[model samples]
Target chain A: MNTFMGYERPNGDIGIRNHLLIIPTVICSNQVCSRIMQLVPGTVAIPHQHGCSQIGADKERTFEVLAGTGKNPNVGGVIVISLGCEVVDPYALADDIRKTGKPVEVFDIQSVGGSVKAIKHGTELARRMLEELERQPKVPIPLSRLKVAVKCGGSDATSGLASNPALGAAADALIAAGGTVVIGETTEIIGAEHVLAQRCATPDTAERLYHIVGRFEREVERMGADMRGGNPSPGNIEGGLSTIEEKSLGCISKCGKAPIKGVIEYAERLPEGGLYFMDSPGNDIECVSGMAAGGVHIVCFTTGRGTPTGAAVVPVIKITGNKRMYDRMEDNMDVDVSAMLEGAMSLESAGERIWQEILEIADGKWTKSETLGHQEFSINRIGPSL
Target chain B: MKQQIADGVDALIMDNRDHVATVLREIMSGDTVRYRDDHGIREITAIDLIPFGHKIAIEVLDTGDDVCKYGEIIGRACFAILVGQHVHVHNIEGIRGRGDRAGKAGT
Candidate 1:
């Protein structure tokens, strides 16, 4: 059996990484949380501008992403810090993460006194968690247990021509090996949704796919704005993507040819062992963050124009079909498949190269994004904060 | 067997059903570019100075015809286009995400 060394969590999930995550329950707690992460080595922090003034589904989304990040199999333990008066229930969030059978602790900055005192308290707690996390043993786990997310950003024509399709081939290989793959960026799938809808495992799945796309379109319509104004962004247009449809056609190719098992909401816990599609925004950091919150162990991000985005908890492997961009942004890119266009490399070979990179990363090799300290995290918000 | 030309391949046609091909390298006007697809190697003369990664019409298209690439309709030709002409925002209009252009044939 093909296997990679991973941290086997008590919940029976295999984690390619063992991280001590520091989470801020509200925007007010960001400074304290950041201070703790800065004070403690081997700890990661996700500080977002949310958790307060959000109502209904929006509030639930913030809570879900926060709790989900803590519950990710990659996290050995979590320390949630909150402002005592925030709308989000920090204790409830901690309880949710604790259900994963991992150690979870929560504290409030106001309750601990203030910034200075809270920073000290959080740092001590984070240090203890990191020490415990460092003691966790790594065990060999079947590669079939891994869940990977596929995404593309800063895309150009070469993304469609080479990298995305090569990534697709790799995605297919992982699925065939019994792993799970999730693809997102609903807006990016606008033109090519019909193609994806056809790949749904069931008629209901197909209908849900169309429904989410339609809902996103109607939401954009409600704002009396054109999605084209934001999508096929200026950089995308300069990179030779003429329309949203052209961009979508290329974007959808990264998930490979597997039948989409299901369509899921953003930050929703993914089902096991197949290809799934998550409805998400096309923004680079936000999309990757959602996948991280959805419990993906790694993200394969294809870029043509180049971007340096990574997730707070997930390792991002940046692949680019633009050799020029890769050369220019070598510090940010992980794999360069541009040779496929030159005929020096074949698509299948490129896919194999990426698959090997995935296995190596899963086995504890650091990616460019991870080494560069690009732990970017953001939540997609649906409504304005009060 | 057909001879496989290794050099001077400046563009790629992803599918036989595609109406457009993407230029892999910059091509000056009047330059002959060779592209390969499943059908085999074919050549077209560039009518415009096509930049790298941009599309060139592989088939002539009338106004309002769907422009296909990757064997899928990507957009609609906004005006008459001849083979080898650059196909982009100037001649091809996106059929999706444009609130004003909704309900088009491809949408």
Candidate 2:
């Protein structure tokens, strides 16, 4: 129980998966990268629509997410494909990932002649990488090396009453074993930020938590709009969540009662143990993407209405507390704790169900989203694209 | 305690101080449901039709009073809430992050 199986990288990082990742440096090269992935069986490709006409932190984010994805321990090697005329430099991207000591190959469409030629060239490189990746062995890794991200979406009344608290218990269990846990969704924590601030491990950490919440609020106020309808989304109200405060009180319980060790910016790497809060949005795909880019190995997402999102790199384990949604969307759900509502299960046992599933996934169990090929990826944009 | 309900309890009063109990099943107006709080097992009558996962006021709440759940203030009552009345957005108004109430004190 103290160790889970993973592939150890040269940089001293452990990888639960050994994948050959194809990264497109710009939207123009996405097609070539997709073609390469189609031609190579065991490779994964991320075809995002950014990387051109970006400036400032906006441009930096795209590059950082790509580099971080490449550097991710889950990826054994990377093939950086560019259009040769984009703002992001393909060589620089490769160099950033090289710091992780993983094998990386870079090329641009202009230098390779065209999309057709680029796809052909990338396929050749990917085939070799896939062969090398297939040979990697998964060894037992200590639990202290594991980092998990706790997230929730499509929330309803049951989310607060059951799933979030259950996930919180499971998160506490992992932290007790010396693993790290991160909770995100800054927008969702609006009405309950003070409650979280009080649980921060230090005054500095508490200030950072308030600073992020205050900064986000100021931006909204400056725009002359309220976060009401958007945050409690129509779905949230229909599911019986009455107000932002009520929804938030329920939302904060998913991270358990662990003291907040630190507060990190969106896509910022997490520190070693306890619960760290990430200042990320409530959007499911964007939140999961930031956590993966921040180097989390897995995500435990709790929902009442059900969502079928999986990360391009890490496995997403979906948990639900609504019996109706679980039965209706059984294909998308990985764990169910609805028995709590029916008075058939205890809270500790509900959390234990999710805890056991996490250990199983760390040892290479494919989540429902992964089995369905739901490798959803997205990067949250902070500023307008130039 | 996450409010450990002994087996067979039909509803939950999450905290001893909460004025509302979330119904676990649909109940018609005037139906009685059993719930447990730190006060021990008790029964409350529904003054309005309540759906599963929706809260029922177990204590009378006057307008502008802080509505509590999980032992914390979730919002303020916008109207008088009678015991057993279904509590929801129609009755409670959140006091935080309101752009519409900007610059107003004690709204």
Candidate 3:
């Protein structure tokens, strides 16, 4: 099909799901916001251990993630819950989310009396907002309007051999159809940055690509720690990956052959209609969260060893190339391209399978991650907490 | 025309320029393994037992030589590597990602 049913946002973006999101501005407000989510069915809540005791960039990162999560097209309405004395400003946070033209309501525990009263007040607001969100109509939107993030984690040999390249083919197909695709994981791109740099659309983009990898390497040095200590984690080694270079060569294949449009900071908004790179950590949950905050509609996560991490505001479609892992983790995996390894299916055919899954997901089909309630969220931090 | 090798394909070569191919399954020493890529199918005898997913050198490499895979340099050979030998961290050092060796050759 040329189009899928989606909620058209007032900011001219298309969202596959219309969700009422309950956002807690700090760890102190998590219980109350989660209580509201439990009270109101169909409402989603992101409870993170940040927004308090965080200084400078760390504090700003928390605010950005909360605001970005609320501004995400998938969230039709938002409730910003604050502890009243946290570092994050609730009114400003609500106003930031309002830039998307979505309905945002802000409240605080101290101002609303106590936990019991706050929960009651938040529940009432959430119930009304959920009812309003449910009334939002799904209109037919062109598939090209979709923005997808490409990520791989728990990678093994099959990840590089089958799933990654297959996803790359799908990424290429989507880009060819005029859709936007994003690839991240700055740490994972170290050994293979040259290959990606050569594919950059401009000389400046190529230089920036190198700059980020160099910067990440220097940061790892500042800690007097070897990146190899953490990278190619024991799990990766057990799964047959020998070195970070081998793993990286495989990791970079998931973005397909599209020219790199530009490099963006973590959680930065993505440009429309091309392949872009977001500088993010290789940590699965944080990378996926960054993409969701950057306004991606979906994330196609490829794995061989397997993981069940999903995003709070975007659907994550898990694809694997190991038949055994797929069978072993059937509940977590969505598409199995292991047939390609056995020569039963060609790469193009395997990619077509993932592409079809993407279309189905875009048409409102729930991914295994979403159905299993995997709304894992984490913000990649660059600074220390106060 | 590119020839297609019969079954028993135990490894996969991603490109013609690759110095190594990935073992798809456990391969014992002396086993004549088959591999295929865009260029065509080829066979090589395993000199050492290679574990699944680990790479095996497809071509000989002298010390300090760059090991190419996926048609790009993934690492550098720290010592001589012969065809059919297991290619890994023991013999090849990563050219990137290590801060101490950022601009240095074969660690």
**TM-score for every candidate vs. truth?**
0.96, 0.96, 0.94
Cα shift from native, residue A135, model 3 (Å): 1.7
Alpha-carbon runs more than 4 Å astray in model 1: B1-7, B101-107
A1-386 in candidate 1: lDDT tens per residue? Answer: 39999998888977989889989999989988888888887899999999999999999999999988998898999999989998899999999999989999889987899999998888888878788888888999999998999999999999998899999989999999999999999999888999999999999999999999988877766655456647888888778888888899999989999999999899999888999999999999888888988999999999999999888889999999998898899999999999888878777888999999999999999999899999999999987889
Q: What is the TM-score (0 to 1) of candidate 3?
A: 0.94
* Better model by TM-score: candidate 2 vs candidate 3: 2
Q: Candidate 3 lDDT, tens digit per residue, A1-386?
A: 88999998888878999989999999999999889888988999999888888888788887888888888888899999999999999999999989889999999999999999999999999888888888888899998999999999999889988899899999998999899999999999988888999999999999999999989888876665456648888788777776677889899889999999999988888999999999999999998998899999999999998899888989999999999889899999999999888878788888999999999999999999999988999988877777
Residue range with the least summed lDDT across 10 consecutive positions in model 2 chain A: A219-228
lDDT of 3 at A28: 97
lDDT assessment of candidate 2: 0.88
Which one is best on lDDT?
1
DockQ of 1: 0.47
Let me know the TM-score candidate 1 reaches against the reference structure.
Answer: 0.96
Q: Report, to 2 decimal places, the DockQ of model 3.
A: 0.42
For candidate 3 chain A, the 10 contiguous residues with the lowest summed lDDT are A220-229
Give the alpha carbon lDDT tens digit for every residue of B1-107 in model 1: 01222456888776778898888898899999888776667888999988889999889999999998888888899899999899888898877666754544545
Listed models, DockQ each: 0.47, 0.57, 0.42
DockQ winner between candidates 1 and 2: 2
Which pairs clash in model 2? none
